[model samples]
Target: MPPSPAQIRSLVTAYLDRHPGEHDALAPLTSALDSAGDPTSRTTLPGHVTCSVAVIDRGARVLHVLHRGTGLLLAPGGHVEAADETLLAAALREVEEEAGIPASALVLTADFRDGPIDIDVHDIDASPARAEAAHQHDDFRFVVHLADDAPDLTLQVEEVGGAAWLPFEEVSSPTLRAKLVASGLDGAIRPVKLEQHAAEHPAPAVRTEPAAVAPAGAPSGTVPNIVGVHLYLERDGHVLLGRRHPDAAYAGGSWHTLAGHLEAEAATAGLVREAYEEAGLVIDPADLELVHTVHMVERPGDDPRIGLFFRARRWEGVPEVREPDRCVGWRWWRAEDLPEPIVPYTRVAIEGIQAGRAYSELGWAR
Candidate 1:
């Protein structure tokens, strides 16, 4: 069954939360929902909702098809069908039908959850042969990651004249291109949680660049960066450090500060959780203060991240290795005489904090 009007409204509401500026532009869609006709129906005049899918490969290229009807290169999409359970299902179905790519070969990015990454409204030319008036299309654009080794394309020749993979910057939609470039996905569909990979194995330092972050004064619709929290606990002239387990995916066997990605929580709250989970230290939210922030790209061609470092003025309990697979041990090191083999960004952050600098950047092009 096609999604209900209520479901469609909910999807738009959620999308609007991420892009409040579009409320006026999307008035047609909101108005259509209140009309007597079904917005999902192609015959519904003036405008109707449609689903589109952006298929991204591991190299971060977007698969675009030469659409025959419009004589334009665009993401695979069309009218929603009764058999489609939701907009997402409709989008996946369109991709499979037009590109010959199976749904099994793709995965949705964790960032948007089940919602469309972008919603675009465009005008469609009237078709005299079909006796159809000119109308608008409310396109709900969903993004998917193609598997690294997916099969070659088999375009539905009748509709798609040809298909090609283009860099994100080359995508036709300025809004879609900006969102994709800001996301810095590099073909990786982010895992829901980093802790899931916390197992004892000699995995190479996770070949990651950095987390997501939306910088101050960023334009609306820019994808936010992956946020993380780092705990800065100090006693006397020494600071706390941990030895990540030798088998960890990231910075294995390296000394680093107690840190973690922010899960549906405030930065300070996330830091408090990491302190207790990784080191068994009890912290009061009142005792924490923002100290430093690192806007860094760990490597070239990766998404940038925003790291929040918080200083704890007072805390209870001794630090211990609570998650052995993530961190094997905890210790203190002097500011002037820190231990070797620390995570590079961790070292930069420590120096900045000591030097009383509130912000630092790494790996960004000059």
Candidate 2:
């Protein structure tokens, strides 16, 4: 005859009181209460106990198995603490800490059963070392949803040796059930081993370039005339405009096309790279048709600057100020109704884009 529900509850409560801080010892106490069939005899065992269990699922139909060095397989569960106000809190906490999954991500699939009579404690320690251990949990069990298709199991290294999903048919055996029950007490299954290999691998060396010296022929602090690509993207006859951030030194509070200075380090791909970063839009470099390259010699004693403008017929994503420090706003405006206080260089590029000219030879034309 199975132990009465009241007797089982009393046994669990007593056991919990004796093992105040022993998390692993609760397994044996549970096992002892489970095996006691006589209601009168059950009183001999500890009665006070508080523990938690998790019924985890992977949103599928397969069962997760772990090799925890115990002969029996079981679900994931552990003892509750004085700080744990309720068993549900304890159950969710244990699953996350032991399984490395967030509690919020797990969906509780079953109602928690109370009383020791509803629990099972199987003891099957094939190993002599585990058999002699006083506080070893042979296994613990949880009913988790495993799909017909297997899901990836990322095992917590400290708690489980290895984990896998086994078919229900493969697990429905008396011998396997006994082993699973033992392992479940500890919340682990056996891990698979792999082979080792040794091979020759070489480390690469790093290279460095020397600092540059000022050329005697050139003036001091002369900004180079960078040949860059400017994108004049027109949608429904309105040109896309990128508003310069107020903090910019040259063109603060001015609107300009998507453009940047060419970098020698980027080879011929600087235009493609800059267009994407400045406008938060991507376009194929090959698709950019060179609309014009303006050769502008700055006013005497002013920094010399040159600009290359390109028109792209195709691109991806809506324009936005990806770098708020460099650009604060963006909008689409018709060529006839341009925004005020536009930069002189940007104005020249816009004129060329509007005229549909292939090149604009500009030299202090203002």
Question: What TM-score does candidate 1 get on C-alpha atoms?
Answer: 0.53
Please give the distance, in angstroms, between residue 205's alpha carbon in candidate 1 and its true position after superposition: 32
Candidate 2 lDDT, 1-366, residue by residue in tens = 122334334545643463355346555555554653432221232332333333323322223335365423434455544333233444445655555544433322212112121233343334455344322232223332221222245566666665444443345334334433433332211111110000000010000100121223557553334344567778888888878766453366788777765533342266677667667688887777767677766456332345667778788887776656556888999877788878676677777767776555555656
Cα lDDT, all candidates: 0.78, 0.46
Compose the digit string of candidate 1's lDDT tens values, residues 1-366.
Answer: 466676688789989998999999998899889877888999988889998888988788999999898799998989998766567778888888899987756655657645788999988899999898999999999887886555789899999999989999999888788878887578765643322111111111121111332233667545545577889888998999999866555677899888887655777777788788778899999999999999988777544578888999999999997777567888989988888899888889899999999999988889
Give the C-alpha lDDT of model 1.
0.78
- TM-score of every candidate: 0.53, 0.38
Using TM-score as the measure, the top candidate is 1
Model 2 scores worst on lDDT over the 10 consecutive residues at 197-206
Root-mean-square deviation (CA) per prediction: 14.8, 25.9
Which candidate number maximizes lDDT? 1
